[model samples]
Target: MNDMEEDGRRTTMTTTKTRGIRLAKEENEKTDVRKYIPPLDGQYVEKWLNDSQNPGQVGEELVKQQFLLDLLHSKISARYERGLETAEIDEHAWQVQNSITAIKRRLKQLVDTVPPVVSLETTDSRCIEMYEEKQLMATQGMLRADILEERQRVARLCWQLHNTGEDTKEMVNEDPKNDEQEWVERCKLEEAARSALLEEINRLRSTCADLRARLEMEALSNEVPKYDSL
Candidate 1:
């Protein structure tokens, strides 16, 4: 009777082990399927397609096409990462991906596009020259506008200071303590003016940096020949 009980226990243990192995294999297969599948953004595509109420608006249709293209682009990238087979990847898929890439390249040409965060500022003279020229043009335009405004402001401030100074002089003759208090007030005003000037100078410096960056971008765009056009 004890021998029969032992045999029964061993059979139960084996069955449990087999079931565990089967479950693990099933889980692994599911994981493999998930790994092969690509993630996608759907809302972006919808927004692109329905931006305009009228179907006649060409811009909306173009935008919709671009969104679809972007989706295809993402799909292709995901497939590549997932190791999709050439034979498995259909011609239609490639066409959509190609269209997306082509449109993106054209869009880049029309605007001063922001580059990826990883692209560092190049140290090469030609690269630097490109950067500087764009920066200079953008900066000069901004600076000229700013300088004109600043000149007007400075004239107004000077007139205000002159008027305040005359008022202080009159107050000093009326009372000695009043004169001292007026002098302190004047010092405070001067300090505030100095601080404002410093701030303006800093702002100009920042504008200069922005100009330089814009110039560089413009220069780079011009210098780089388009192989597609060629």
Candidate 2:
């Protein structure tokens, strides 16, 4: 019975040892995938090689993990590039919009700074009346000046005639005592000078008449006719 009891305990001890070893192996297997290549990092890809079945399988799996990582990296890089392109397009669109707005603002500013040209014609009787009045005043002034100049010229001619008559009367009184020939020659010279002066006065009168006619024609040409306003 003692030997049988010792054998039963030994059998129990062996069974427990076997169960513990199996559990420890399962625990080690749970951490094995992490130790192989870190699943995502390919932690030691160079150290893995196909030397045996186990190593070969690990190498193959590591390569697959590396390929998966590279594929994900490529996907992220492509998305980053697309994002950059989209940002640039948005920025360019914004710049174009700003340029259009600036151009519109500049065009408006240029338009605002320009002055508009328009005709000045008006149908106002008051303006025409005022212009006619100004022309009448000017014509009256010119006529008065010409008449005054003519009057002064007539006065001078009268004075010269008075002097000549006085000299003739003095010569007649001295005719019996002085040379009649000298007196006759002096009268002739005086008459010639008076005739020249008279000619000059007539010429001046003609010039004044022509000037007045010209001024009237010019005023008539520049005059604005009266029209009824609407």
Candidate with the greatest lDDT versus the true structure:
1
Clashing pairs in 2: none
Summarize candidate 1's per-residue lDDT along 1-230 as a digit string, tens digits: 99999999999999999999999999998874533322223334345333424433433334555566555545654664465643333454455444444444444443325442232333245467746645654654565456556666777988997998788776636567876798799889988997897688768767777766976676666756433211
RMSD of each: 22.1, 47.6
lDDT of each: 0.58, 0.54
List, in order, the clash count of every candidate structure.
6, 0
Q: Tens digit of lDDT per residue, candidate 2, span 1-230? A: 99999999999999999999999999998874645434322223323321223534544554455445345434544554444333443444344334333433444344445553323354334345545644554554455455456567667978987997788775646454465677678779978986886687667655665566656655754653333333
